[model samples]
Target: MATTLKNRSWRLSAAALLLSFSAQAQAPEAAATPAGMSGQEMLFWVLVSLLGVLVLALVLTGILIVVQLRPQLRKVYEMPTVRPSWSGKVLGLFVGDPVLLQGRVRDEIMSGHDYDGIHEFDNDLPPWWKMGFYGTIAFAAVYLFYFHVADAGQLSQAEYETEMKQAALLVSVGSDDPNKLTDFQPLTAAADIGAGKSLFATNCAPCHGAAAEGKVGPNLTDEYWLHGGEVNHVYKTVKFGVQGKGMVAWKGKLSSKQILQVSSYILTLQGSKPANAKEPQGEKDPTATKIAMR
Candidate 1:
């Protein structure tokens, strides 16, 4: 019985020792988890290693090429003692091979024609500069087609007209921005003038005449003025009309933008001829935006 009990006790001790060893192995495996890598990290390292290997192979190939050509290069050409940078080697790609004359390559690119015994080689334009010139030509052709023929893009004049329309539209829609309120910007576009022409014929033509040659009011086509001939002054005169001279204020009846438009149109009438035109009224101002009454 004692012998059997002792064997059972020894077996129990061996089992406990095995459990301890198993626990230690399990703990180390759990601790290693924080130091583990994800699939992306593994892929990144693999790609980097492959790139490094490829770069190494290319370097080795370049070294081999240099070694193979060294003997020929030493025999035929005079190479610089100092080594060139990798960037210089990259620039050499565009520059082509070095000359056998041991001088700058530009010195060899002389014109073929000679003057006063001065010999000249062929004049070849740089590929980069020629490419830029060709690119500008292509751009000009595309611009002509797109803006003039196809009408796919806007020209400077077209863009100006479009912006003016948008601005006037905003004003018509009752926008109350201070910039728009005090806006003295005048548009000389034909469409803008046409809109103003309609307003003028309906309102001011009784006094100013259809051709702005003046009836009861002063001649607008002449280089003479009642108030002033500057753009902003013209706009102001139209806005708050000269009440004492039988010119009624149209501010309440017309929009500020409409008044400005008519003012710009009136400026365009300078130097125009009309049948039975009224005589000029006011003194000429030097600062007037005039195109001379010719």
Candidate 2:
């Protein structure tokens, strides 16, 4: 009976061993991955994100370093306090220490004179001014060395001439076209006749009646044209007075367009009856045109 039990136990052990081998054979193999990241892509992404954060942190640290260092760099370039020499020291003792001398001198100079104990010193320029003057001389010497002798940042005569020529080219007047004339032609619209009327009333009303009837000057309302009736010609005559004629040219005072508008307004006066119309003086207009001045 004991022998039989041992055989059964051995059979059970062999069966268990076979079952373990089968399980091992059936298991899936792990896939090969670059950088040993297989099956842990999430962890890999987390590590990559951390690296980017670290790079950004480094950049911010660099910027902060630059900002903190700037003021220290500026201090490096600032002027240092100057120490007085033997001569300056001696002068300071007699004139109240150099540091305090400025205030003392200023007080003495500004203090009013008294009748019994009268005393006053003329206001003098501060020591800072003298120092500044010396500094200016030093700077001028340095500038002369750099710009004249060393030729550093200096403009040659040829370069200066070229620059001047370019500037002249930009603004030089090239032609006498009417469009180029900037001084004349202040008004150009037909509606500006009202403005012309005002001007005529103020200036021409004394010679020619307010109604433009002949008075000291020839009748303007009549068709008898003294000078050319054209607008341009009338503008010219108004701008430049006719030689030996009473009309004087108003070129410099009134703009060309203003003169033109006034001329047009005058044409509108043709044949209009005024309160007092002078008898016809010059040759009548061949056109026999009639216009109402209203």
Tens-place lDDT digits, model 2, residues 26-92: 7555634557565589557745765665555555554544455555433442324322444444334
Q: Least lDDT summed over 10 consecutive residues: which range in candidate 1? A: 96-105
lDDT of 1 by residue, 113-224 (tens): 6688887755456555666899999999999998889999888998999998888766643323323334466667777787778888999899888888888887888788
List the candidates' TM-scores in order.
0.36, 0.34
**TM-score for candidate 2:** 0.34
Q: What lDDT does the true structure give each of the candidates?
A: 0.67, 0.62
As for candidate 1, its clashing pairs are 110-121, 111-120, 111-121, 112-120, 112-121
In model 2, the runs with Cα more than 4 Å from the true position are: 1-190, 287-294
Q: Which portions of model 1 miss their true places by more than 4 Å?
A: 1-183, 290-294
